[model samples]
Target: MNDLPAFLLRKADEYNAPSFIPADPICVPHSFSKKQDIEIAGFFAAIFAWGNRTTIIGKTKELMALMGNSPHNFILHHKEKERERLLGFKHRTFTATDLLWFVQVLQQHYQRYDSLETAFFPTPVKAQEHAVKHGLIRLQQTFFSTPGAPMRTRKHLSSPERNSGCKRLNMFLRWMVRHDNSGVDFGLWKNIAPADLIMPIDLHVARVAKRFGLMERKLPDWQAAEELTAYFRTIDPEDPVRFDFALFGLGVLEKF
Candidate 1:
């Protein structure tokens, strides 16, 4: 237990290989080249990234197909008739209505910005505490800022204001921000720093964190994410979320 961070670091190195990308929702973004395409694909994939991993990957691929496998182009220029393909799409609580609102809001957002990072971090990403969490809240405010956005769509996005862990958005930020030789994370964003990123606390990560004595919180809420990230930051403040691969692989793959 004393050497837990070292062991987790080893596991992170072991599991963060290029080979791990194919079976992951991250693959949806890796399939594309353009930055906008990667960002768009990764955003939708992260939103659908709950429940069974296999099912998540499958449904995400279906979503890409609906966008004609060109997410940025589809979001910007798809004709009204083409949106019919998004009908009947369902993944857990994310229904067709939710998807439709996302498309519309994203389309509206892209009208002014070239990437989701700009939409999320409209202001300069200062080195303030809870900057990432504040950005998530701002993203929600901006997403629903315009008219015609369904109230239900707001439920799909999480915010620190609601005390949500915001696992999906944090994970999406990891995909966009964390840069490493490891081929898993896309590292496409330049605004947000990896140091400011929060942990994406789900059941698996929570279980591993508690077992390793890294987390004391009873529930995987926003507070737990902060506590866990704080611990990891003590060890590696500049790139704490890389421990995500270790916790995920240990919990889901190795049963640690």
Candidate 2:
């Protein structure tokens, strides 16, 4: 409070964070095999991915199909029944091949298991690390998911390809974590904290954040997210990500 910028300090009073907004995307077939499967299906949807919306839309739909929803049922029919249907190969469309690859790997790695939380994280390092250790990278065409490695946060994007991957994961996390109705709640990440989370910064929001004096560092990378998240931490240490909507909307809406 003592050193915060005048503008950011105001958001504490300006925004009313939604109590919840459909963390439907994070549920995986493993942890999601039981309850709230719609959320898991939604978690698979590519909603809120960072990139051109056009590209993301198709990918989202494809992911939906892979999650066992009917490819023809654009209305998300399975959203109600929460059935365990799989997309027959002949009916496939709209999904990213990479995502399908990951899903397949998930099926391979956790075939006997369930629960993205127990099957994935709460370890010493982030989930990406365990993915690598389990040879998920071998599952990849090139870059493998490695344990104890840097994550694909907003700042870590090195190239357009990496940037795309970052968007995919971010979109996935958004649907899975914060979003509510999209699927079943794995509840794996529930006890985990936001300070433990990283910001998914994009150029537009980075620029806006800077203009608003939210962050001033020139080079956008892991450091920038750290700094920005740190400042937000000042507002709500337990859930700095709660400010994500306000910050992202500030940029997207071009609000000064």
Candidate 3:
């Protein structure tokens, strides 16, 4: 495995390009330039990213259209009656009910803060290890903090506290925090360093990590995600999760 780092670097460079965007859910957010729009759009895209890539992109685009393609503005200013446009929307198990709650939470959040980064950090502090873990925990708490928050919607947002890998949320963080000239990841938020970002583990990432001897956990839980991220950090301490492009592309696109 001495050459594994070089192999990963090559693969990461191969896939982390603008060409990688069109067929993936990341395209949903790439369609927008506003920071909040990207955050809101990317959040939905990541959350809806299951089953099939085409379906995920389609559903996310439909959601954005329902919001009149100005997600941040729509979430902040749309009337209660305007929400009816989202009535029949459904992506896999995510229903209109879930979307409404999401809108409510986002509206409440954006009303107070200009960006979604604060929802994760809530305060300015120097970058620290385990920042993403704490941020995920805090986000789950704040998401469900509203009075009478639906129990059904809780399934949509996973937390490390629940032993979930929080794949979708971690993926969203990757979209928001990973900075590069590659133009794939947005790098819109600076509070969390890319180094501290945990690997967003799904079946694809898990399979690739195991094949490359990066992880051993049988279950792809939060521990497995952390284990894989820890391994990558050994190779590139400052920007470990950049290897995600390699692992995910190998598993999903190359079927390795």
Candidate 4:
């Protein structure tokens, strides 16, 4: 276990580079320079990141193109009549209905707040240890706060309350909150510290973590995600989730 930190650091440094962006869903947000555009694009990319990487990137870019490649402007000012262009959009189970609802909620949110980071905070009080967990719960609440939100869309947004791993949302938060000169993760948001961010666990991450003895949970639920992250914190308390690049690279790229 003593060698684990050096190993992870090497893999993280290897994968957390500009070259890693083009072939991954992170490329969607990398396409934009503006903060709002990155947040909006990154959110969609993360939400659509379940299947093949190629398909995920392709669908994200398609959606961006449909929005005239200015997602922030299109989300805030585009008329209802103009939304007809989005009517036929579909990425797996994320149908046009779900997409429209997302747009509506985002439009409402950006109207009052300049950044999507505000949605995660929800309240003024500081939550030190469980910030990401609480933030995700609040985000889901705000996401479905609007009347006529589709029941089906709930599956798209996972939360710790439901014992979900919340892989997508956590990944989105990592992109916005984790600071580094890697030129990969955006690190645009400052309210949530990098230490508070939870590890974004998927099957690949779970398998790798368990093999490393960093995790012991059989099921990749919210508890397992938290457990894995706890172990990672021991290795690098301030930037534990940075190991995500290492685990992901090992599992998906190196096939470790």
Candidate 5:
């Protein structure tokens, strides 16, 4: 695995795994010892999570100000010393749903730590309202929430599209964990094993995994995720997602 180019591998891993930055506002610590600090950091992360670290280059300030003015949107203590780096919209890319989804999270957090002081929060259950509001979450007819709901997948499916979804979701999760983009303080919730996790099947990851013989099914879809995950389960049932890096690395480094 290390045979792949270091920088390329790093980029692949950067996109594949969670690198929780400290400045991210959504990275709720497992222990709420310093809750406010963690939540603020988590916020910073989710904001930049849309694509990559480079994607959300400098959008912290705008979000911070939005938090300040939108009382219902954000909660921060007046007395707390804020990070100056988080002062302005260094480079903002706005989507109404993104802001709305963020506030919904705050509404839940406030139920406990009434003040805007930083507090650790775990990944809250994804609400349908937020999905519909921001129109980000995917809606597939076959994607029901029932236990082991079946989704459609033809055998001919290939990479890029099939595995791309996981890329997006994983990127989002990374944003959910860090305070900044640097992984300086790994969040408390970093041990999450992505069992029964949905595959964000984009063409890139799927084609790559298939080329490495990790996936037998040519079609990349929900069934593909399940089939591939079953094989990985045997390798390390406790945390099968580890294969994602190896598989993704194959594609990024063009090893396959």
Candidate 6:
């Protein structure tokens, strides 16, 4: 409707090419075929998707190797001796303790639900705004509810209720939920509508959004993610988060 929307659409098209997948953490999940493997790999990759991109990919590969490149199987049935291989793994502040706890939680979760989506949105979806926010809250609760979960590991799994931007989790959601002819996104989860997805507002995206008059918030928090996603919806109600590539690309690649 507006020039801003059109311009962003153009940028999204420019950036959302098939070739972009290889350089991203999403590639880790893409390399796997099984649904559970994809979910497990993507979740691990996303949680560690901070700091440098090269470092992120490297660590993700290392972690995957430790899992024997079979993430779901590894998480569900890792022997005690096999888990010792993960003892020295560390990505930023996410250390071996956090990784082991995640495996434990995933085991508990898979025992109950068929997919991770159910663990997040266990209740029926009512007609409501911020249902995704509610899902994230429930997911946090479920994650920490695992037996012997250390309070220290809670920071890795963000809570939107706490005003966190939750950039990485939202990015993982994008990888799982948004599909296009371009094939960058997976569109694996059918329960969550694409319209409900929010922008993963990292620093690069936030800077680009501000430069384009898409956001006024100084902090890239939950409020900023909502504001930015609402603005993007005006441009494309069916898939507002498509513009996430545009925002992130404009900032990171074009240096806008």
lDDT for predicted candidate 3 compared with the true structure: 0.91
After superposition, candidate 5 runs with Cα above 4 Å error: 1-53, 57-94, 112-167, 170-187, 190-201, 216-220, 253-256
Model 3: which residue pairs collide? none
- Candidate 1 lDDT over 101-164, as tens digits, reads 8998889888888888987776667678888988898899888888878988888898989999
User: Per-residue CA lDDT of candidate 5, range 1-256, in tens?
Assistant: 4333344335444644344322232333322244453445344444354444444434543454455633433443332243232343333444443343334345545755543322322233342222211222221211233344322321111222344233444433333333334343333343232343333344666887676566777766555765665666665554445455556555544555
Q: Which tens-of-lDDT digit does each residue in 74-172 have in candidate 4?
A: 999999898999999999999999999999999999999999999997444344878888899989999997788899999999989999999999999
Model 3, stretches more than 4 Å misplaced? Answer: none
Among these predictions, the greatest TM-score belongs to: 3
- lDDT (tens digit, per residue) of candidate 2 on 1-256: 3555455545523432332222222322333343334434444443334455445445555555565553223222334233323333221332233333434434434444343433323343343312322321222322235343223321321222332223334333333344233222223354233345545567765777787677787755556765776777776765555455566556654454
Model 3 residue 168 distance off true place after TM-score fit, in angstroms: 1.0
Point out where model 6 deviates above 4 Å: 123-127
What lDDT is reached at residue 232 by model 6? 86
Query: What digit string (tens of lDDT, one per residue) describes model 3 on residues 1-256?
Result: 7799999999999999999999999999999989899999999999998879999999999999999999999999999899999999998889988999999999999999999999998765476767888988899888998799999999999999989998888989999989899999998887778888998899998998888778898878999999888888898998988998999899999999
Overall lDDT per candidate, in order of appearance: 0.89, 0.43, 0.91, 0.91, 0.41, 0.86
Q: Estimate the TM-score of every prediction.
A: 0.97, 0.56, 0.97, 0.97, 0.45, 0.96
In candidate 5, where is summed lDDT lowest over 10 consecutive residues? 133-142
For model 5 the local lDDT of residue 142 reads 15
- Give me the overall lDDT of model 5: 0.41
Q: RMSD in angstroms, candidate 5? A: 11.1
What shift in Å separates residue 96 of candidate 2 from its native position after superposition? 5.7
